[model samples]
Target: MRNLIHVLFFALVVSFSFSCKEEPRTPPNILFIAVDDLRPELGCYGKSYVHSPNLDQLAAESSLFENHYVTVPTCGASRYNLITGQLPKNPGDLSNQASVSNIANKPAGERPTTFMQELKQNGYYTVGIGKISHHPDGYVYGYHEPKSDKIELPGSWDEMLLKAGKWGTGHNAFFGYADGTNRNGMAKEVKPYEAGEVGDDGYPDGLTAELAIEKLKSLKQQDKPFFLGVGFFKPHLPFTAPKGYWDLYDEENIPLAPFAEIPENSSKASLQNSGELNQYKLGEEKPHLDRVASDAYARKLRHGYLAAVSYIDAQIGKLLDELEEQELAENTIVVVWGDHGWHLGDQKTWGKHTVFDNALHSVLMIKRPGESGQRISQVVSTTDIYPTIMELTNVPSQATLDGESMVSLMENPAAKHWRNTAYSYFRRGISLRTPQYRLTKYFRDQPPAMELYNHQNDPYESKNVANEKPKVVKQLMPIWKKGNTGIFKE
Candidate 1:
């Protein structure tokens, strides 16, 4: 009898131990959020002006990347590089319809494999929402099907104009209905009735958030792992947000650009360039005004941008809250990234066209199950996201990705010698950003442009030390060339 009891207790102990020791499930669901044209100006990145409480909370719980950059500053180029995990060879004049139409119009299998396609192949239900593409067609980024049952939402201003029928002049001015007939009759600057209320009926970000919450609820009931890409279309242009968000910041309290005064010897290459003019389209409608002389107008523009950011942040918070409510937070990996950075009157440039820090640097935050809450200073690019996600989710990706995976850094935030420098490029300019410096070289056809900023000493990039630091420039120029050649191989 004694031996029988001892054997029974031993069997129970072994069974319990095995149950506890069974390998924890490694396949984690992925929640990927891509915000458009967002600069690293959040409270998490040490900016005090932007009210990003949810993002700040997320940073504290995630592995925050301090020196993350985009492959290109422009919309189409950056998106193409990010989705393909490769640098985009200058599409040049071939970007028009005549060139693209001749190529096959088939979906994922016919084209280069995207990160999304890889996920779908690995038995993950992949879904995309909102402005995932720079174009209106929205078939470019390898999404095989639309996730939502609703009719496709209008993504751009042109689409909105097509629906509303001559709504307002296509300019950055307060727009209201000329006749008080509908919700369009409401003042553009008027606050919404409530914080979460939706007016104007067709706000894309709010609609995207709504659709994502519905998807998340559905995924919760399913047994299979999933990949959800929720793309927000706000804070990009038109700067239209719920009026409550616009009311969040007082115009008087809005912070001015760190360097509002353009120095007398500022880069003529930057000044003569119509980068800002192209963005604002001043001469097309109204006479152009000097940015320096129109600080008030600039402030209004900044206010609108901040409002749009806050509105997007709120929508993101809603989706994240749904993930938590559905008990997916423990098993899901969330990555929030901006496709590229934007410019708000920086260097007299209004949009993302230059190789400046404001244009090139993007915000990347990765929150995994068991990662440390620390900021990583190593330089990384948006190109790295594809490989990192694949590795983390244990999905097999056959495509040759250009980026080196940072999976090691996720576990050990202080991994040494991971990467030395990160590279970003525009049409004819290339920028190499290291921990201590940034060096830019523009093609001679445009202007004899060179900018060198010693980040260790001058974080704001105030002084142009290119002429003074000839030896440094020579050393860094080769590094940039090597990076470009190594990545593109053309």
Candidate 2:
């Protein structure tokens, strides 16, 4: 009887100890979707005519940022700020080759090249598909050059995959047309828009989405967490989509840019001749700072852009569906972000490069594990994404970041004492976007280098009120100088 009692007691003790042992908590997975040149012109942003149902639905279920702005107005520089969590320190930091010059082939120092690299160091499986970095395929290659073995952000991604299909290379597929022709091979002879009669797979973004879904299936089998960054290339340039997306809108019903004319009392340095649009040599009409494109042509281009947005929206829907099907939605953090905004004949410009609101404002939505969807109207910067991701995953950072963690804002978007400020740098100017005003200071030898627009009175930014509002300029100058990190001097 004594032996029996001792045996049972020992067994009970072992059972209790086993039950009390803490199982290692699985880290939350991250699904980061980056869309190129996607402005705040979607249905969620109150553009009823734009067919972006997928993104709108996602916004309804996620924390939608109403005043999210990029650190820079261009693709590469903006993405650089996003990935590095740093301000522009040199001229290269403001250009398309920012990634290649600063990050590629560099040995890991005290600071990792990107937040993705930091995640990898912390035992997360990082995978990048398509244009997560400056290069279309995340490789160091020119638009016309053959694919190279050189990785763009080495050590950051465990796998950087690109399915070029009939286009031969990623860069070619980026600007590819329906017939497998690209602008690089044809010397920019292609038109600015194409409505192909084929299906979604006819374009590279469709291939990207399919590849991401397949990857998710594989990731589900892994015993660790993943940080998958899937980038969609659309609505960027040569606005091309399947005929089905183009059919979603009526050409005549598409509205033209309301503020298509240049602002009153603004310097010519503040505007460009739509040079990026004219690069499409076969484009029907050329728009200049003084010469606005005809309304008919403007509507057509806007129609093409909306179609591209709808097409990308479908790809995003596919990704979200796969996440739910894999049961990853419950444990994963999903973020849909736009690299930068585009100007569809806004201020008579057809591209993004200036420091205007059209070029700075972009889409930002974050769906965390337990958070309910809400709209955050406070101004936030692209650099804030880095620290936010790190904090969410509980990954420690080795280097100091420029932007503050938005975790507090994410938890309580209506949290008081929130910083409602965002800064955008471009065209030799640093533009500061406060809640009710936009003040831009340009570094130039010319006069009237400052431009201010009060959103409280003139939301359209129709006039430069720097001379009219001296007190406002004085109040904003100190904040504006914070973002002028000597890149202009470089």
Candidate 3:
């Protein structure tokens, strides 16, 4: 009887121990990356000539969003719309200073203070490196001013770092070249593009990749899941990359921008004056609404831009390779996004300040471990990325996400009940994109205040048929007004 009792007790102890043994459940890690002024001109996006094998491989294993659009065509505004998961609430929010001029002042207790802050509060290690916000170095500082302790997205990051290198401050680095000379400091005397004879490390983006790789290893040692953001500055302005990337392209064979003339019957207010390109004082040619850069100079600019794209692609490949090396690729979710598309001489413009497709469309690719590659052609907005991240990680919070998740579309490209429209605001113009149309309503215009383009008929948006297509305008009118509620001053 004594032996029987002892055996029973031992069995009970063993059962309790087995039940209490903690099952290792590693939550999915998120590797979120953002590139500045990158359009979907890569080989994966079917731009046959672009030498982007790294991004092509990524897209091959992920859900490629062919028609991704940003809320605002400019950088700061588009990034704000993305990080906050909201539309531009006011006209001033459409400027290039959106993060600093708009969001950095609000209190943390207020509306969702950045999705990163929410993730950090929910026990995830959140780290931001390089131009994650309006500021290039992830901190707030005046143009040409020394770095300050004031952070843009306060309380959002457990670690914020940047190797500014020879670029000095973040703002200066925002427009720096491979030789450590910046656009502003050089007094605009430097050429708008450069093909450095040095290696990849001669540029800031190479150093950024180095930091990201180190961070990934550090994050792996932690017991909790992490949200790591690595923002690359390239293909933005003062296009400069190593000579090797430039050699990858034949400058003479590089194609000219598809659309260079302004749309017919569109108001002057509908297009930008290309002043952003003008800032490159040494640019061989100036582009305008009525005139475009010389074809030769335009080809040179395109070649430089493509070289920068390939350089950034190599850096991205480095980070991804390290993720797989650390055995983290199977459990990590990878996202590669471009803030907004740039006009490569489209619409007689070279910058991204218009409501046109060249300025609004961007790159959005997502890779879920163990998932096959699929293409989603629906019109999705950058604002949706925040909610999609939350859904993927199963993290709960008290936030009302303005964007919807793409989980269903990721699983099935033909998913039903998906959003068929997206909205973007720039200057006084409000552009709405449906599956088959691109409509614009300029708040500052009179009687002919509306503009419409049937994408089914004119993909280049070369004509505004608003007057001819009253029926289509009537159908999209209500959507335009509804989209204007928070964006317009009224």
TM-scores, one per candidate: 0.80, 0.95, 0.94
lDDT of 1 at 395: 80
Off by over 4 Å in 1: 1-26, 92-110, 140-202, 261-293, 446-449, 486-490
Candidate 1 displacement at residue 104 in angstroms: 6.5
What lDDT tens digits, residue by residue, belong to model 2 across residues 156-261? 9999999889999999999999889998999998899999998999999999999999999999998879999999999888899999999999999998887887
Q: Runs in model 3 with CA error above 4 Å? A: 1-24
What TM-score does candidate 3 reach? 0.94
Q: Model 3, range 170-259, lDDT digits (tens) per residue?
A: 877778887788887888887789999878778888989999999999999998889999999999988899999999999889999776
- C-alpha lDDT of residue 116 in model 1: 70
Decide which is better by TM-score, 1 or 2: 2
Where does the lowest 10-residue lDDT sum fall in candidate 3? 103-112
Model 2, residue 230: distance off in Å is: 0.7
In terms of lDDT, the poorest run of 10 residues in model 2 is: 104-113
- CA lDDT of every candidate: 0.66, 0.90, 0.86
Per residue, candidate 1 scores C-alpha lDDT tens digits across 351-415 of 67767788888889999976657788888888788899888988888887878788887777677
Arrange candidates, best lDDT first. 2, 3, 1
